[model samples]
Target chain A: MKKWELKPAKDLGLPATERFRSLRRESGLVSTGMQLAWWSMVRGYMAVWHRLQITGKHHIPVQSPFIMVANHASHLDALVLASPLTWRLCDRIFLVAAGDVFFETPMVSAFAAGMLNALPLWRKKCGPRAMGQLRQRLLEEPCSYILFPEGSRSRDGQSTGFKPGLGMLVAETSVPVVPCYLDGSFEAMKPNQRLPRPRKIRLNIGEPVSFETVANQREGWVQIAETMERRVLELAPRRGA
Target chain B: MSPAARDRLFGFSHAFDNPVTLVVTLVVGSLLLLAPMLVWWLAWTGRIDRKMKSELITRYWSWLVITPLILGPILLGAAWTIVGIAILSLLCYREYARATGLFREKAVSAVVVLAIVLRSFAELDHWYRLFVALVPFTVGIIAIVAILRDKPEGYIQRVSLGVLGYVLFGSCLGHLGYLANDQNYRPILILIFLSVELNDIFAFIVGKLLGKRKLAPNTSPKKTVAGAVGALVLTTLLVMGLGSFVFRGTVLAGPGYLAFMGMLISILGQFGDLMLSSIKRDLGVKDMAATIPGHGGLLDRFDSIILVAPGVFHFINYFVGVGADQSVHIFTGG
Candidate 1:
């Protein structure tokens, strides 16, 4: 007989708040249910409120161990990107969110972790160690991530340079990074806005890119980030097109 | 529902109607009140160090919150008690699932959860036949739902974990909830809880004073042979003394029957503790989860009650029949 293999939850011993902020957090049945409900509601809201549109939907990978990187402009970017995915992927798809914004307070942390199914990234103190753990979880658990390579929401309508932290996750690995472009989110809900307007939104998903040959170092991370940024830029609708 | 059944379900006015309930509540209340003084005395006398003192205080605070949460439901009404137990069953199952990696199999977990809800419903409706029927029905459902994944690899492990989870958390703990169906459930549950908790304390205290030989060192390093025997003797006596009051006029009032029931509680409670210990050992974890501050997880604190619930439930049920005189199919109106 084969030996029984038991792998306990990675965040088993952490307290509730710490568990929310930990990169090792894994969603159980309750959180999964909550995320599904919340995401389904978000999907409906995006469809009705924003009249969200998608292009190249078939470019999205159907399996795990993939990364979806898009330009960060508004609070609704993650929601918009995740809305197009199938319901089966709801539990496995984690929106990599900013710690200070999403997990600063206990109540906010609960909402972010429980409803959004997000894992925290402490932008101020994000070191290679944190990135390494994220990379390991991405490949080991074979879970997909919805990331904004610009690290934070863009204050203005223009996108920012992609951060090297995104490269650290996919570099020297076979995991595919799909670049997506989101339009009209900035106009709908800017960083300073409290509420969103009913502006039409569009999402264009580019083909997935791999960084298997890229080194897991400074230059390689930069190269991966630049390549991803270029791919996302190529998907954006040209001016007055 | 009849007035009697109504009183048993939602009648908080008669929380202290039974003498046993009153006495147990007072005793638990006194213990909670006096605990702080005792801790202060120990700290002043320097019997325990600062770290140990702080740990004890943390545990006390946790219990301070936990005791009210537990006693409130039992006193509120049978309906609340059953609901509380159902919630407990779900939480315990969640911890077990996360620990054993069983929650990953969403289909099997959902079936187990649904079965537990159904068990709670059966208990509330006072439908014994359906209550008994659900065990097999759930097992069958778990087996069927597990195969839906169509992945043959590790099928046995998944099914076995799901079944074990259901049996331990849903079925065994469900018996405790079913006890609330009886008219005199408040006192009976209080006695069982008191004895089971004191059984652990007795074992720890006695083991510290006189324990020399280790009992299942690999399973639980701290448990000693003396502790097991001491708890067995002390808990049995506690039950015999308390059982006479709780079971007053029933056939279970007899010393012989009470002794047997007490022994059963102690033995099964110890076994339950050992069972959890074995699980933790196998899974390479110290505590199930960091739920309760100083005590580890809810499972750690309530492990003794799990097996004891079913054992004592059946023992009493066979002798006197639980909820025998109560209205059946209260909700369904059959």
Candidate 2:
């Protein structure tokens, strides 16, 4: 006889307020339904408003346990990056959002967790422990993440140097990190803008790269970050073209 | 629909027509009013510490909110009572699904949810035949819907979990709603809810005072044999005293029959509590969810009522049929 596997929800014991902010939070039927509806609406809005276009969509791994790292310029960066993926993967995909911006208030936290299906990354207080938890979830739940390697959105349109935190999640693991670039998002919705403009947006996805040989140390993390940064930057259009 | 059926479904004027309903309402109201004074007295005597005092007050506040939500619907009419039960069924199933990891099977969950809605419709329409048929019908649908995933692995587990969820929450709890079909449903439901909740309190108090031996410690460590026996005696007596009025002039009103019904409520209520405990032990979860302040999930608060609902429902149904004089198929007339 085969023993049955019983896995309780990871965030089962937490209070309701804390559950929304917990990294271990898992969505049930209601939250999943909400996310599906929210994402579907967002997809429609993006198509009509931004005239969103995608290139190299085939580069997205058919299965999960992968990471999608893109340049962050606008609040719509995560939405644009996630819009092209199949709806079947909606529940398993978690956007690693900024905790302070997305999760500080109760209403916003609910929106982020319930609608966007985002997991918080506290940039100010984040340490290796938080990064380690994210890494473990990616490989164990075999789920995918949509993260911004630049850590935070750029003040100006120019891209910033990729932070080493991105390497902490995928260093020396078989998990593939697919580099992506978002063009015209800064023009559409800058960090200071309250509402997004009706500018067209383009998403360029590059082939996935793995860091299995790289050591799980600071130097290796920095190296992986630089390589990913270069790959994403290369996908962007020429500066003067 | 007949005028009598309309009166039972939506008429609030007759909410207190039954003396038993009036007494139960007064008793619950008095308890809520006196609880704060009792807590203050305990605090003054230094019998309970500050933390315990605050916890007790928090629990009392939660009950204050919960009592009105429960009694308001029953007072309004049977229609609202059925709707309330339907919502409770969905929330309880949600907690169960999340705890058992069955929520991951979206297909099976959708089938279970659809079955619950259908069962609610049956109850609302007062369609007894369809209400009874839904149990097996839903189990079959769950089995079929689970296969659509095309993955045979864990097929039995998923199907079994879905069936059990539907049976426990959708069907068993639905019986409580179905009882509203009775013309005297307000008093009957109040009696059942009051006794079931009191049964838990009796066990706790008696166990604290005189309990020595463990009663299935592995299943529920805090439960004692003395507590169970004490509750069985007290609750049976409570029911015998109160149930005579609720079941007046019916076959169930006899002393012997009422005593038997009381014992059934107490025993089955204990079993229901233990059943949820066993599930928690299996899943290694303490409480289902932190829904109610100081009381854990709705399942945790109302676990005793689940089994007691069906057990007491059928017992009365057998002796003197439930809703015998009330109009049937009120919404879906033949």
Candidate 3:
């Protein structure tokens, strides 16, 4: 019916839903009133993004929890991604951030740890040692998570390749990852750009990619990354497209 | 045995008419009145940082919407209190266990419920000793025995830790129940509660009426020396006058003593409040629990109670712990 509805159906182009299943991923956010307050603020911030309007939000099940993954093109990616999910999920939620950057500042650290549900990704601390506990946190909490598979910011305003790290996370948790693309945020604020333009931005979220569907296919990682890039390419500015 | 059993179970509410109990309650209460003012003074004088705000909305929702409309009257009244208290204890225990991660693998809910039930016995004098024994001993044994089957690692150590926490945080606090209807005990409870109440009341009125200086700009922005004074004044009045009602005029005291003790309790009550606030700041929890819509958890309500109980207990003992007739019904709460 609406862009929001179509976007969820297939627009973001994901390898499999499990690649970004929010529930199957680790929940590092603490649910607190302060967090809930900040979450609402983040939602408002997303609405002002290109005047985005949500529809058929209920297509997302009220009871069933899912995983959320999106193409990270700008700093605003987490807010835009977490916003729609907040409107849909209505419970404790979180996003994965680099432990080195987000967890370093006291204020940001408090916000991340307090209730925004931030999980830290460290390149140095790779493998099961990290995956095992993240897996446990997911099982223990009925929370949804938002992850950017690229792990770092993408320059030149395009979705980067999906790293094996993301696929590894998919294998361990086996949760659905809903691939989403930002139509205007890359240009709204890109690499080396300290500020955003007043132009309208659109975020297209796709149905989840199931890990079960992609687990055996090792080649699926590049295919998944390329698929995410292709979907965002569809939503890119007409000139960028 | 039927009447005898019921009689043993439920003692009629009682009080004392003595010099010792009366003086103790008065002096302890008097100091409570002065506490908030001193705190306000510090905040106004730029000593304690005005870092925190009242966050009144959250508290109002808890007290007005949840407690009064849903759980409060039940707790302070008939039939519902036992269950209310159990629920309260459970939530408090949940917050603690979840925060500390001490009893990570154990079912804190079931354990809290069991502890609450056993602790309830302490309220009934007939089973007081049993209540104390149930926690550190009986529950301890049962938990150890139960865990034996699982053969959990550090079996004895885990059970001991769990039982100790349950006893300290859960059951030992049950002594609040013994406070219900006892006159001798009521003096201390009343004085302490009144003084703490006075802190909020006088601080509000005085701060509004005459406050000119902010005590602690960084720690607590709104507090003032004037507000602290207001709290002290109100508590002194209660210590000298409201107490007269409790004593039926027999609890004699000079106005000077009343003023002096009132000042003391006012100070202590404020100390208690600040202590509670500090704990919340450390843990980063707005309230102890979300159960009470406006009031907060039992910990929140009992924040000052922890300090007031022992403070006024000794105060009542010193003031009203005298005279033949007064001692007759002392523990009986006659």
TM-score, predicted candidate 2 vs. hidden true structure: 0.98
Q: Which stretches of candidate 1 lie above 4 Å from their native place?
A: none
Candidate 1, residues B1-334, lDDT tens digits: the string is 8888888899999999889889888988999999989998999999999998999999999999989888999999999999999999999999999999998999899999999999999999999999999999989988898888788787899999999999999999999999999988999999989899999999999999999999999999999999999999999999999899899999999999999999999999999999999999999999999999999999999999999999999999999999988999999897
Candidate 3 C-alpha lDDT tens digits along B218-324: 43457787887778788778777755655444443556556666766777666665665664564455564433434555566655544544444345436654222
Model 2: colliding residue pairs:
none
Evaluated at residue A136, the lDDT of candidate 3 is 54
Pitting candidate 1 against candidate 3, the one with the higher TM-score is: 1
Q: How well does candidate 2 score on lDDT at residue A151? A: 88
Reference-based TM-score of each model: 0.98, 0.98, 0.43
Mind giving the per-residue lDDT tens digits that candidate 2 earns over A1-241?
Answer: 4568888888886887799999999988788899999899999999999999999999999889899998899999999998988988989999999999999999999999999999999999899999999999999998999999888999898888999998899888999999999999999998879999999999999999999999999999999999999999999977688
Give one clash count per candidate, in the order shown. Answer: 0, 0, 87
Q: Write the per-residue lDDT of candidate 3 for residues A15-95, one digit (tens) a residue.
A: 122212322322212234455677788777666645765433433334333556667778877877766654435434567
The 10-residue segment of model 1 chain A with minimum total lDDT is: A1-10
RMSD in angstroms between candidate 3 and the native structure over all alpha carbons: 17.3
> lDDT per model, in order?
0.93, 0.93, 0.53
Residue-by-residue lDDT tens digits, candidate 1, A63-116: 998999999899999999998899889888898999889999999999999999
RMSD of each: 1.3, 1.4, 17.3
